[model samples]
Target: MFNLSYKAQRYLILFGFLTIPVVLSLMFSYYPAFSLLYYSFTDWTGLGWEMHWVGFANYKEVFTRPEIFSVFEHNAYYFVGGLIQTAVALFFAVILTGKLKGRNVFRAMLFLPYVLHSVAIVIMFKNVYHSEYGSLNLFLQSIGLGSWQQEWLGNPHLVNVSLAFISVWKFFGLSMVIFIGALQSIPADLYEAAKIDGASGWQAFRFITVPSIRSVIEMMMILTLTGALEAFDIPYIMMLGANGTDTFVSKTVDMAFKFQQAGLASAMAVVLLLIVMFFIFIQRKLLFRGGE
Candidate 1:
C-alpha cells in the first residue's frame, strides 16, 4: 500500500466531497441537452420507442423553410430589443449611482419588477396592452394621442414590437441592478483624482467608470444575449393560440408540444444554443482576454 502525506490525503477527501455534487448536477443538467442534440438528427416525436436517424435533414429543413427563417429574423429582433433595454438600464444605473436624491428608493422600485414571477408579469401586461379598455389606450386617448392607439399584441406587424416592450419592462430592472452594483464597486478616489487633474465629468466617466466596470459590462452583455436568444415565455403567453402572429419567436413550444415535432424543436434549440455559445466565445475573446 502507498502512503500519502497528510496534506495530500486531506485534499483528496475534500475533492471527493466537492466533486460528488458537481458530477451529479452535470449529469442531470447536461444530459437533457445532449439528448436534445442527438434527437435533432433523428425523427423522434418525443414519444414511443422507435426513432429513425435522419442526419442533417432537420438542419436543411430549418434553413430552407421560410417559417424557420422568419423565426430566426424575429429572434434577431428580440436580441436588438434586449440590447436597447440594456442600454436604457445602464443609463438609469449611472444616474442612480451618481450624486442623486432618493437613489435608494429608485433602485428598489426598479428592482421590484425583477422579483415578480414572469408569468404573473406577462398576464398583467396582457391586460395593460388590450386595445379598447386597456389603461395604455385610455391614457393615450386622455393625452389626445388616440391616433396612436391600436391593437398592440393582436396586430401581426406590432406583435413583436409589443412583446419587445414588455420584455424590456420586465428585464431592464435586472440589468439596472447589475449595473448599479458594478458602478458602486468602482472607487470614488479614481473620480476625485480625475477631477483634480482637470478631467470633465464625461471624461471621468469614459475613462474611469467605464474601464473600472468593464468586466461586469462584459458579463451583462453575455447574459443579455443569452436571455434574448432563449426568450420564450413572454412571447408565447402574449400570443397564445393566435394565428398569423405564430412566427418563429412564438412557435418553439408549440412546435414541440402542439405539433409533436420534437425533433425539429430540438434542432431549433440546438441552433439557439450554438448562437449563444458563439456570442459567449466572442465576448470572452474581446473583453476577457487580458488581465487589464
Candidate 2:
C-alpha cells in the first residue's frame, strides 16, 4: 500500500469535515447560479420547457430597455438613503459608545428597529405617512408648520424618498451596532496618550478615533452600499414597485412571477450581480486595499 505525505494526509482529514457543507453549497448555491446563468441566455419563460437559446439577446435587451432603466434609478434612491442611514447610525454609535448615562438602554432602543418585522414596520409607517390625517401631517399642523406637510407615499417625487426613509429607520440600528462593536474594541490607551500630549477633543477624535475605526467605517460603507443596492422589502410591501419606487431585485422578482419573463429576469439578475461585483471590486481596490 502507498503512504500519503503528511500534508496530503492532513488535507484529506480537513476535506472530510468540509466535504458535506462544500458539496451541499455547490449543489444548492452554485448549481442554481450556473443554471440561472445558462438560462439567462435562453428564452425560457418560467411556465414552459421550450427554452430556446437566444445568445446575448437577453443581455442586450436588458440594457437597451428603458423601463428597466427607470428601475435602476429607483435603486439609486435607496442607495443614497442607505448612506444617510449609515451616517446617522454612525453619529448615534459614536455618542453611545462614549461616556454617557444609560448607554446600554440607549443601545437597545436604537437596535430595536432592526429586529422588527418589515411587514409590521411597513404597516405602521403607512399610517404615519398618510397624507391627510396621518400622524406626520397632524404633528406638522399642531406644531405650526403645516406647510411642511406633503404626501409622503402618494406623490411620485416623494414616494421613493419616503420609502427610503422608512428603510433607513428600520435598518440604521444594524450599522449602529456594528459601529459600537468596532468603537468599543479600540484601545483606551491611545486616547489617554493623546490627551497627555494636550490633544483637544476634536484632535483626539480626528487623529485617534477616526484612524482606529477607519476599517469598520469602510466595512460599513460597503455593507450600506450593498444593502441599498438590493433594497426591496419596504418598497415592495408599501408601493409594490409602483409610483417609480422599483428596485432591481424587486423588478427582477416582478418579471419572473408577474410577467413570467424568467429568462429576461435571470438576465437582469446577472447584470445586477455584475454591477454589484463591479462596485465591490472598485471599493476593495480603491478604498480597502489602497495602501497595499
- The lDDT of each candidate is 0.81, 0.88
C-alpha RMSD (angstroms) for model 1: 3.0
The residue-by-residue lDDT of candidate 1 on 1-292, one tens digit each, is 1398888899999999999998998899888878889999998887785789999998888778787656655666567888898888989999999889999999989888878887898889878889978888999999999999989877778878778778788888999999998998988898889999999988988988888888887887788778777777777776773634444535667778888888888898787677779889987987687734
Q: Candidate 2: what lDDT?
A: 0.88
Best by TM-score: 2
Clashing pairs in 2: none
Worst 10 residues of 1 by lDDT: 241-250
Q: What are the clashing pairs of model 1?
A: none
TM-score of each: 0.89, 0.93
lDDT string for model 2 (57-154, tens) is: 99999999888867778878878988888878878988998999999999999899999999999999988999987999999999999999999888
Model 2 off-target regions past 4 Å?
Answer: 1-13
